[model samples]
Target chain A: MSAFDIYIKSINDVLEELKNSGRRINVFNVPSSCSELPRTIPVNIGGNANPGIILRQDTYVELGNPEAGSSAIMISTNETGLINDGRITLIGPDIPESADKSLPFGQVILIGGASLDDKEHETLQQPGFVGDKIEGYMIRSLPQNIWSRISKDGAAKGFNFECLGKALIYLYKSENPKIESMEIIFITSAKDDVKLLDNISEQVRKISKEITKENWKIKGYDIDCELDCSSCGDKSVCDDIRDVLKSRKKKGLVK
Target chain B: MINIYSQLMSAANKSLFGLTLGPQNESDGPFIMGNGDFFIEIPVAFGCSFSDLTLTGAMGTGLPNAAELIDKGTEVGVESRLCNAIKVATYYLEAGLLKTPDMIITTNSCCDAMDTLGNLLNGYKPWAHIPRFNMHAPHSYDDASYEYMGKQLRQAVKFMEDVTGRKMDMDRLREVCIESNKQCQLLLEFQELKKAKPCPAEPDLAREGAEFKNWSKDRISPQVTEWLEILVKETEKQVKEKKGIEGVDEKIRFLWQDLAGSWASGTVLARLQKELGAVCVMDYVSFGTWTPVDLSSEEAMFTSFGKRFLLEDPMNRQALHTTDLFCNDILQIVKDFSCDAVILPAHIAHRDTNSRIKVVRDMCHEKGIPCLVLGIDIWDKRYMTPDVAFDRMKTFFEISGLL
Candidate 1:
């Protein structure tokens, strides 16, 4: 199967564009399963063990920071051969080569498996963005636009592209066993390149937005109102209350 | 995993949802406030179907017409400066949006908005003919004061008997008291779990259950108690696993002292957590602070209710009584919860809490706990939007070196 859901654009276009972009791109292939990756970083869920810390003074590099430019996306397809199992592609400079600098970063994770469905796009997204889940790697809020830091300690410990890629591979493979083929692309070349990734990410986000609401429905959260604000006069004011309450309801808060 | 607060609140709400209207119970049909109050117990003990739409109607800011309803209330007679909660409640009551009750039991240990609202409902033209009883709370907290309120509660029971033409089941009320005590115990255990490092729960979750605060404690059902049991277990599991709010690094932990707290759908805290790894460890609703009531005698039951009424209720504890309780509670929460800062939301309607803000802030600062006073209404976002509150906090964090 070559064409699958959530990949509104063909995967070949991404490969072709990266090859023609004149940027240095390196591909490192690893073992297919998480158990085979180097034991450099384990899955640290619930937050960075030392949160909001690793002060700016302690960070050697800030990637895809909002100040520079930030873009990220996780796209999945059930097509065979579309994803090279355990392949990590770095389209820009790696950590040791680009220290003491803030760079526009772009990350795109391509996953492929026969059992993958469009409904689980968010479930796929959850573990793919390894925030504080990786040691000494602290990511600033929400991953839709990824901004992260590599602590000085982490860099000194040889936490480079290979280690980072291996950590990602470990987390994705461990959390999602059904993922048969996974390929990651990291672009720290230019803001324009990150924007290029963002443009492609938006198409998938269109489908993502709908599936997210579907996920909410499964969790017993709904609009909770009969009136369509599209026709109401006080839609703007009600919209604020509606959005907040909807989230609260998702958490099972009382009326 | 679902956070501790959401699990418990959902369990608390679901356990009590349609409780009085359940197939197993007969209906007397009473209307009461659902602001986590216990006055619903009188009707609940009598097998009454509680049709309280206060929260269901206007107080649910989710309702599309919430703002419209509040505005309508202002247009009628309510002052524009009044709380949006009471404003919308007034409009809905006048509009007959909520189902009318056979009898109304109004308790006023909380605030003026409630007291005035009770007064209006008691004398309102449409509801005037409805048999009503008032438990006017006095400011003093002595034996005579509790005796006065307890006497009112007894009279309220008599009034209930006179209206429903049904005799009070002493045994059922006793059983309800016993169940309520169990809820208090479970609540304490649940609260104790929050003191865990990394705070194995969400901030807003701790900001709920105000409805379970006082006289309303007697409305505690086995489901709520069992749910609380489950909540304790769930939180315990999280603590054992060393779990905390997902993705939060927890560099900073603070206590929120808002009257209604931040109802921004977690936007405020979510931003703080994402940007700074800052977490709100506890809020005013953090603890089930009240102890179990004495049930050895019928008179002790009502007197305990009065004690919980004046001493445990938010309004009586912080709003009406001395500023000492207000400052003491804040300082205590800061130490108990291991917080780095405090956010005291200055709700516009809570002038009493607002007036004592300086005292609370100075005390917190003197103890090296950074305190932030925000000009926002916790229940009504129109006063200060979530984005604005978040920006203020971000600035405060920067100034306080918590960034």
Candidate 2:
């Protein structure tokens, strides 16, 4: 299976179990700044994408209108999470089978990040971003909050899940992925979460050995974790601790 | 003056023909008439010395009013006041307003002014070009920039030589520099004159020093040299006797920021200095000239570029960094000089970056020094003329009681 397709399958399995358990859940898809990486110039171009706005892109319509039997789940993406097309996709499932396909939805709202241009003389003269909001297919902005959050607890806090959630949103906004009574999955890039997948896989092994529940059975799969800092495989900013360690060793402070 | 006119009338003066001079007032007229081609308007720099004549081309039509010009165009528009100045110079040039100097040399101290003038001259004829040199604002004095500017001065000398068909004569240059130093010293003295309870010199003299750039002219020895020396002696005597100049008013002191005179209310600042009893003790241009110590290099071209470009780097860095070092230096000057307040007139184009304002305001605020931030343009006076701007400033000052 393709990499993103495998990701989709694994995440669906987790979501399916969560849905059957009757807990309300949300998934946001986001893109990594990798694709927009500049050919020249030392400055990173990816920070321009605001994370909060990306999470809210397709969820704007869902936030506006409410339905009787429909549960709302927002899928967001960032960095590696974006689809081939620039459009960020969102997928919402209707509670009833018939209402799923035919539900009328509001317009897809796209959220861009904070822009440097917005910090213009007049804009800076005011309190915030000059109340000059952007609503379009492709937008630009600085995700200040997201950068802070990622900086603090990025690797340990299941950030891969959040990153994948953002990507899922991107896919849905593009392909408009449909979810029915089938199982849901949660694919992630965290090593610890991948170990949790081992637990799920072990549980699936036991369930397969004996007779299990009737409705939602999670046939387990482990989350794949690939860490490549040089090429940027994930959306979080990894501390270049290796450099600090190497410097220490070189200085004879550490082995 | 009439004898010189009569003498010129007898001889065939061929210099005024091909120049298209213009837009200068009638009182400053006929100085640049010749037998060249077409004399468009008035020759504003006719009797001025050669180097002074060089900047005469700089005299262009001031925009009618800021509001009318801005109203006619979009938000981001290039107002061509500088272009009109160059064209005026060109009109006189073609009409032989000058003795027909071969090349044009332009300096960029007035931001868009010289840039526009240079481009207009180049566009008029491909060969007719002014090599662009930038003047550092007097206040910005970093060591590295000073060194760079020294090199730029050397290079500017070469440029001037090429344009004026004259070699860089060190003796002549030293003479010019000494003469120019006298003017700068006079200005410094004038600045010091403000210490008097009622200043001895008119505050408007400072404005004339800032705007007209009389120091930049050649032949500085004759008129200004003699006049300023005598004035300095007279003003010193008057000050010793505790006497004030007649027709002069007392003024307070303030810091000025983001006051580039274009498409904005320069009149506001002019008026504030007048009616509000406030003298701009610290300004971007006044503080920007922090010259370098080590500019002696063998390669004249590189040294010249380094000098001019580095000095100009502060203005260039305006887009990136929030607070300009030049502004910071002015703030330091404010603290040291015991100025009352810093008045910042940030207009639409310059308001986006809050670096300079942020630093100055925060520093001044923390120090408990009164700093006023005014949002207005320094050049375009469409919405308000000098009188109206002065009136508003007077009201503001009276209400604040800083006067």
| Interface DockQ of each model | 0.01, 0.01
Question: Which CAPRI level is candidate 1?
Answer: incorrect
Cα error of candidate 2 at position B270, Å: 7.0
Task: Give the top-scoring candidate (lDDT).
Answer: 1
**DockQ (C-alpha) of model 2?**
0.01
Q: In candidate 1, residue B336 scores what lDDT?
A: 49
Report the C-alpha lDDT of model 2 over B1-403, residue by residue, as the tens digit: 3432233222211222112133222232122211111111001112222232323533222334424333332222335332333344444444444443333334433234444444444454433443433333233323345456555555545655554454654544444444544554454454444344454544444433423223222224445555455545555665556664353354566656543444322455445545555655545443322111112333433343343344433343332222333333444556433467666665434533332455456557765667666554343444345565456556656666766
Per-candidate iRMSD: 20.8, 26.3
Worst 10 residues of 1 chain B by lDDT: B17-26
lDDT of 2: 0.35
The C-alpha lDDT values of all candidates are 0.64, 0.35
Across residues A85-183, which tens digit of lDDT does each residue of candidate 2 receive? 233322333212221121322111222222212112111221112111211111211110011112112222222323423432333232222211011
Off by over 4 Å in 2: A1-255, B1-101, B104-166, B210-219, B243-251, B258-324, B347-355, B384-403
